[model samples]
Target: MEFKDYYKILAIDEKANASVIKASYRKLARKYHPDVSKEENAEAQFKEVGEAYAVLKDPEKRAEYDLLRAQGTYRSAGGSYQPPPDWQSSHAGNRTHSQRTDENFSDFFDSIFGAHGSDFRQAEDFQRSTNRRGRDLHYKIALFLEEAFVGCQRQIALRVSEPDQNGSIKQRDKTLNVKIPAGVTEGQHIRLTGQGELGIGGGKAGDLLLEIEFAPHPYFTVDGMNILLTLPVTCWEAALGSTVEVPTLRGKVKLKIPQAANSGNKLRIKGKGLISKGGEISGDQIVTLQVSLPKERSSEAKALYRQLAECESHFNPRQAFER
Candidate 1:
């Protein structure tokens, strides 16, 4: 079986933290998700991405993969390689060794970690209740950060198996309207009780667990509850400071830029980012000051800039560089 560099597949540094790994996964998952992706071989890419994340997301699996990678020679681009025999035995011994009956995974995965990966367990946990309950179904819900803060309802459709006439299972499309609560962040799971598969005779149905993911927003980048926004300012605005109106999901809020605010300077606005239910915690909006020049420099503007340059000759911005 081919050796797969899980970290390389996810396009992350080997030293990346869990949050970084998750962010990369979410971005790639959205781009290559078979249901929405426009790229060729999206289905295959999605599975590869999923498989890679399945290993690295778990601490134990990641450690074992790292051990195998160090012991054997494997390239990031992924050439032919196999795990040393007893690779699993040598490392963590308490993990499940069962291969998934589902044929959706790769042979490379089966050769080492097998179907006991997190993806399958996340979708259908093997340790389900033995009380004749229906199997729990897993689903993913994508939302913009704005929608997450305000809460919204979504209608999703999925095909599920149900018992038909003569006690045989048949595929049927199921539509569900899920209510997402406010302040929901990425990776949060919401369970809808008894919304999963049809139970057997006189048995209760299982629950549907909706995994939350925030879609990439155009201007805002989320770090936990905090939201980052790059706010553009005129050169004078940075040098002389000015009051500017910034935008949030709620609406426009005025920001006070202090004098001498340099490009890349971050200004904090408390309680303006995102708020949790009952207002327990609020994420501040980090407005990064970005100084911008006019797109087209007119003759007057050019002359004024030259005049300013001459006037500021004594003020060398790079004075600190001189030893």
Candidate 2:
């Protein structure tokens, strides 16, 4: 539980607004997105950026975090300090000041902020008589393609901090049930009120913002509501045209392929894609046809090919390429 200075990560003051935080995060994330970055420790730096944005992007969490910092309890790990008794008990059962997992933070943070119990307790005392709004918390949720299409419920586990009589910090785990609505898109946000950081002075509790992301599927790629799939068809199937069974987010459906259909031909399934939130509109699933050739050929097959090649000598497929 080392102390994390999010302000330093974003190169901004504690007074920076949501826009500033988002701008800084985007700039940094692009520089360290792993796919394009060659810098050493880029991934670590990226994680830190995300963590900072998670707290600073929301007003409630920012306020609560600032409040804790105002108290002597919040300090860098390098600083030497100890907590007094009754600090943890005061902030018990408050979720806004929840402790991040030790795995997510650096060892330096653990050595410094590991004892969050006292900090939270001090925060409680500071707000004992004040009117404060609850803090907003951020959560990242992974969804399957089917879940994203049809909607689903999920159980999420979170770790938080609790205090002891001696003002020592201890880690605790809590589980929550979350309902994911159908047709949820990646990067879309779902808000759950009163599930965020606790408000000070008996004020209203904050909200929890869950950001949606879909797990990679072997067969499909999703872009907004559109579903893209590359379906492999046999040569005969493409040449003769046939009804093929295709898989969608919902289930399998038959697709009619017209005769003489070429490779790379696209077929659309209307209203069979993702559903839009709070709207009756649905996206279309685009299926691209790919022709696969047999790798092995028997002697009879080769003789038949030779006969066909002799009969089709008038057709030169590469005349355009030669020209």
Cα lDDT, all candidates:
0.76, 0.69
lDDT digits (tens) for residues 132-241 of candidate 2? 45568788999988998778999987664433222233566767899999878999999999887544323566788899988989899987788999998887788788
Clashing pairs in 1: none
In model 1, what is the error at residue 236, expressed in angstroms?
1.0
Q: What does candidate 1's lDDT look like per residue over 26-70, in tens digits?
A: 666656655445678877876787778777877876887788788
Which structure among the candidates has the greatest TM-score? 1
User: Which segments of model 2 are wrong by more than 4 Å?
Assistant: 1-130, 161-171
* Residue clash pairs of candidate 2: 1-109, 1-110, 1-113, 1-114, 2-109, 2-110, 2-113, 60-135, 96-197, 96-198
